[model samples]
Target: MAVVNEGALKKMLKQYKYKDLTVREITNVISQYKDLKPVMDAYVFNDGSSRDLMSLTGTVPVSYRGGLENCL
Candidate 1:
């Protein structure tokens, strides 16, 4: 498994090119942002990739897609 150092995590956030901020990055930055949760309710209709959220935030508790427990 690849460990995400602060620099690496910061790089990933930067790659997103978000001017304001992102929910994912917000979670990463503010660990107080309420712990693990998926990006479903955070969506309206098409919330983009469920897979990406899984990859970015790990399992995303109670998510139907399950966890990427195999990836590591």
Candidate 2:
């Protein structure tokens, strides 16, 4: 599982404070945010499963278009 530091986690919460963001945007934040990059890297390089990552990241699972989707 990816471990998000306190600062990065706070920044992430602030980013989502105003409005809802698309999944793509969330992915972009994970990749682009400097602090979050380490968490993303850990997920990518450590053979971390998507489910595990999502759970750690506080993602909400939803049913959309007859498929499972993630929301935050």
Give candidate 1's whole-model lDDT.
Answer: 0.39
Q: lDDT per residue, candidate 2, 1-72, as tens digits? A: 333354554454443443234334445555544233322322354566532132134455578999977665
Cα lDDT listed for each candidate: 0.39, 0.43
Candidate 1 segments whose C-alpha is farther than 4 A from its true place? 1-6, 23-54, 63-72
User: What are the TM-scores, per candidate, against the unseen true structure?
Assistant: 0.24, 0.22
- So what's the TM-score on candidate 2? 0.22
lDDT (tens digit, per residue) of candidate 1 on 6-61: 44445544435561356445555335323333232232347564322223343323
For candidate 2, the 10 contiguous residues with the lowest summed lDDT are 34-43
**Candidate 1: minimum summed lDDT over ten consecutive residues — where?**
35-44
Report, for all candidates in order, the number of backbone clashes: 0, 0
lDDT of candidate 1 at residue 27, scale 0 to 100: 50
